[model samples]
Target: MSDLVARTGRLQQRYEAGCRLVAGCIPFRYRSSDETDVNSEKVVEVLMINSTSGPGLLFPKGGWENDETVEEAAVREAIEEAGVKGDLMDFIGYYHFKSKTHQDEFSPEGLCRAAMFALFVKEELDSWPEQARL
Candidate 1:
């Protein structure tokens, strides 16, 4: 079987010479309601993927590569990790996080700045990269 894990060998870890940048999205879908139009203003439930290596839920995310825009990286991460595709609705916010396992030559502290977006889920795939393991 093919590996479902998202590959990050080509991704860019640094925003510049010293800054670490990451991109991610919060996938969400509107719950079924009496309204005929699915796009109608309804209650929304965020899609949270369970982590195999961690206890808490997580949104799909990864390094923002130098070859792609931030939006593209965010969408790609969502498909690879969450097995979902959607329209990015809006920019949620930026978060700074520290990782113990990510320390490298670029950043000794493993400090990272993440760009987060709100994704309006349009389709949920039956199979995706790492879908089985995730």
Candidate 2:
């Protein structure tokens, strides 16, 4: 797991150094899980975006400031890269790399493992922002 994280850091470095083009997104969904005591479920569509590769593109996110949480960083990234705005209800969960959906790009430090951070937010729009095209 450490190796995978290291690789992700390298990926960030590449994006910063003008080496990599692909950018990741922290897409979030809103769910009924927040309304506890009912044990019921609700489904809704959410929006996300991958950053652009060339000029006018925003920098890819990796590490955050010492006082911030990853959730905050993710939200900030979404706004900068996707131009979407919303509030995080809470952390939904994290998907480990063991899942079949895992994927990672090459990193200089080592190989990488991919993971998804699921967030539950309020009032997420289904439309993709114009900035999301890249």
Candidate 3:
């Protein structure tokens, strides 16, 4: 038999589900991995939603909703917010943007693990749906 199974890791620490949170739909484009764009280029208006909780950078995201994948939700958000025809290109690596508030509201050090994916647009999207930040 072949080993064809996905692996998942459990949190190092336990916490109430109520304390957990998710924030996604941060529009990120492919930069060829060759060009170094350390500095952000607001040229493109990204879709970001502030947490209703307020105080700090938080967006509307969840682990699973009605069996919908994160990528699906992201794409749906982009289309609805930016009106862009985007297609999933590839999966990007994860990163840990550590912060005190993040640890408190989200989880421990690596609690707020973000799912970064690249979106290949069929064409230039309006990008600016309505003064949305990128």
Error of 2 at 132 (Å): 8.7
Off by over 4 Å in 1: 1-5, 34-41
Write one digit per residue (lDDT tens) for candidate 3, span 50-81: 44344544432333233456677556544544
Best by lDDT: 1
RMSD of each: 3.1, 11.5, 12.3
**Can you write out model 2's per-residue Cα lDDT over 17-77, one digit (the tens) per residue?**
3222222234556467557646677657566444344344322233333344556555555
RMSD of 2: 11.5
lDDT per prediction?
A: 0.80, 0.40, 0.44
**What tens-digit string does per-residue lDDT give for candidate 1 at 17-107?**
4557888999998776657777666787889888766688878887888778899989988988888899997999998877646777786
**What lDDT is obtained when candidate 1 is compared to the true structure?**
0.80
Runs of candidate 3 exceeding 4 Å displacement: 1-66, 98-111, 123-134
- TM-score against truth, every candidate: 0.82, 0.37, 0.39
How big is the positional error of residue 109 in model 3, measured in Å on the Cα after superposition? 9.0
